[model samples]
Target: MIKYAVHILFLILVGICWTPAEAQFVNLQIRVEPELSAEVQQELDFGTQITNSGRSQIGLGDVNMGIFSIRAYYTQNVYLNLTFPDALIHSNPAIDQEIPMELSISYNNSGLNRPSESTPLPSEGGLVAIHENTTNLTSTSDIWKEMYIYVYGYIDIGNIPNGEYTGDIVLTVDYD
Candidate 1:
């Protein structure tokens, strides 16, 4: 029993002496960098601008149910015009939107506005309907000093208007 006890004590001592080293007392530092991308659009013909000066191409697919809403904003009275190709019905410049007055819509597509589609443009003059975006716009124009405007629209080419008109599309967004 005495020899056995001695052997066990020796074994314990050997085990303690041979023990592997353990990592201890470490100083660690960490940091985080967030990545972000955002968008804003002005020219409706082109896609919305995303973060900085990036541009996205706009197309028919973006129009929902063939209907579109556009807006324009200017500090003072501005001249907004629509044009028709020379071949179609004679255009009369007298027709225009008066102050606080912004845009004019054919209500329907005047096929003449586009290429071959000569069908009368849908009549949207008397009652112009522009759908509003439910989402609150987060950006502001105070930074850019550019006019902001909005217009409700649809593409109805089967019906022609008094004359084919040319119009510029506008999209309102929060950023530059």
Candidate 2:
């Protein structure tokens, strides 16, 4: 038909104009823009800044959302490890207690400076559990969850008796 002939002609014209596929194009670019912030907790607004960085885009990567490190300097030389929260605190806006989540973090502290040097912490457990937390991390893209570094972090001595305490949080990023 006339339509078929016209389609063939168009293809021929395009082929004449474009070079072979292998050498046709150069400088293909992909990009990812990262934004990081943290959920404001009660009486505390601890947060993390996520930077996707320049000239980078991944199909996916695990991001530890929130602060990465927490350092508390005190007179008595108190110390605490601000661990990452485990699992996404999934909740429906319509429901309160009904939620779905499956996430956890565990590490071994060989007591580098605790107790006896010979005694390992014996897999003394740690958790990345959820809290009543929320953040400005509202995204319309699924790529972020897969390709972003989650900034999961928190402060220490969060549950202690009345005492004068001081600490400063430190968060860092590493790429492989």
Candidate 3:
């Protein structure tokens, strides 16, 4: 039959001159950083113990040192410092003499007013610049902000000879 139709039209012109295949590409990278921390949930109660009835000018007013909460996890925007240890010693160890006391700190946070760089603690204890970030806390959406600590005391107990007195206050959070 004419050599089988010329070998089936030469295999259909070699399958219509076949040709098709080519394409490729690639790329990838990643980097991230930002995290800080702080903790002191709640502890700073200066209550109940205040006995200087002899009164020669001993004002123990405001003394509601409760709810001194501070549970931060910041990444940025921070400036909270409260360091005092210049004087809060009351060691008389049988006339060894060491009675000095004076500390005043105020706060109601969110209303923000304490960070004046703090000055006045020499008489006993001082340094109260509670917060200076001015509400720009920025803890990266962990949803945490609370500052409600108030402690005020000034004693002159007429020649100082009483007893029992201890102190410790150190709260610092950097990055401003």
Candidate 4:
């Protein structure tokens, strides 16, 4: 009975010494980031191939050759450059040879110029600017702005010999 009383007294002492403590709170903040970028792309194409078939004695002047087109994407601006290796060349079948002829280039549907009009291309491969981002240019029916290139062959029929003539118009496109 005395041991039991001692054990009870020890328990009472431990309970009296123990004390309750207050709890605290901690606040935290977090954040996240994302990537914002666009990929640039371009496409260039030529219209129908032009062939001036048979002809009689003609006068001297510029002859319309063909048309070209350019499509750019994912950019607010674009640039176009053209390089002509050689003008329209006339090949003499009898002699099996070719001669370079004087050629010039003009454009319609160019964003750099007035619409529905023609602008001559400079000889030094001038850079043509195109406004309006291509993000909205999704399809052919979409409000797509086309850059039309026109090829013209200058000829003096009186001074040159008659034969089959050929030429190439190269167009390069890029995001500005």
Candidate 5:
């Protein structure tokens, strides 16, 4: 009986003396890259035009056009969407007149200066897959590609009130 009690006390002491195991940790790391970017290199300007009795048109080849540049990962596909205004309102607050306008866009993945040579996007806007040849590598380590966008506008001037008119154009871009 005494031997058994001593064995139990010895086991209790051994359990109380035991220490917890050590904990281990590891270091984790990651590298974040830059996001895609777009910028308006040139503003769309119609300049000064005298309204005639009939409809006045501005072709895609017109001098008054907008230029935009987009940059993204090399060989990565991106989508572009454009929201166009229905009309251009007169600058005068008192003038309650507006001219009906239409807008069109074109793109060149090759970054060519020729807007006419580029592919014409729908007036309603749609997705454009960046061609492999259109990529202009901006960096080597963190590879980046660039493309150009051209915008044109046309207005119907049917003996409407002549004054400075303006509208907004919104362009949205995202990775595919």
Candidate 6:
């Protein structure tokens, strides 16, 4: 027994140079953008007024001011919530008239569409932050960015009882 056949040829050369261990794989991705919008270009008309005993104003560079357009994500940061209507009802549901109001807001990203060179916004609405205007940068508009909102108010026509009057102005935006 030549040392048991050289220990069976060194266990068949260590089982032919053994090997058993392998696992390597990797792949991952992500891209989700599209959600942050507000568009009402204009609609807060305070026209036709006649019953003055007091406040019946409409000044915020009034052109029947009410123009909102905010489509963000170009470095997003926004929060505007305005839910007006203290009083102004009587679309003639038998005319149980009511009129007494006061609302106000303003904003402009300074891209200059001129909402009367807007600024003041705190009649209750707040936090509108988005600043990175590299001359209104555009590599095909850089993934959207536009801000402008203005809505004027005032109406305490003390002797109320006209024919038509309506209310409801709710503009809520998020992501602060």
**Per-model lDDT:** 0.30, 0.27, 0.44, 0.47, 0.75, 0.76
Global Cα RMSD, each model: 19.8, 22.3, 13.9, 13.7, 4.9, 11.0
Model 6, residue pairs in steric clash: none
Ranking by TM-score: 5, 4, 6, 3, 2, 1
Model 5 agreement with the true structure over 1-176: per-residue lDDT tens digits: 99999999999999999989899898889887666778888887766766764455556667768889887766667777789779888888898777788877888876456776788877666676554463454458536667778887777766667778887779877776
- Angstrom error of the Cα, residue 102, model 5: value is 1.0
Q: Write the per-residue lDDT of candidate 6 for residues 32-147, one digit (tens) a residue.
A: 65757777877877677787567767777777778888877666778787897799898878777688888878888754557677788776677776544635565855657778
Candidate 2, residues 76-115: lDDT per residue as tens digits?
Answer: 1112233323322214333222111122222212212111
Ten contiguous residues with the weakest lDDT in model 1: 106-115
- Could you estimate the TM-score for every candidate? 0.17, 0.18, 0.26, 0.41, 0.68, 0.36
Compose the digit string of candidate 4's lDDT tens values, residues 1-176.
99999999999998998889889998876753211122222222222323432222211122324455554322324444566644445665454334344545555444443323666767655555432344555575444354555555533223345556555656555564
Candidate 4 TM-score to native: 0.41
> What are the per-residue Cα lDDT tens digits for candidate 1 across 1-176?
99999999999999989978888897998863212111233223322222233222222323321222223221212222233222212245664421111222222121112212212223222222122222344566421222222232332222333443444343222221
> Per-residue error at 1 for model 5, in Å?
35
For model 3, where is the 10-residue window of minimal lDDT?
54-63
List where candidate 3 sits over 4 angstroms from the true fold. 1-69, 72-90, 96-106, 114-142, 146-148, 161-176
Model 1: how far is 117 from its true place, Å?
A: 33
lDDT score for candidate 4 against the true structure: 0.47
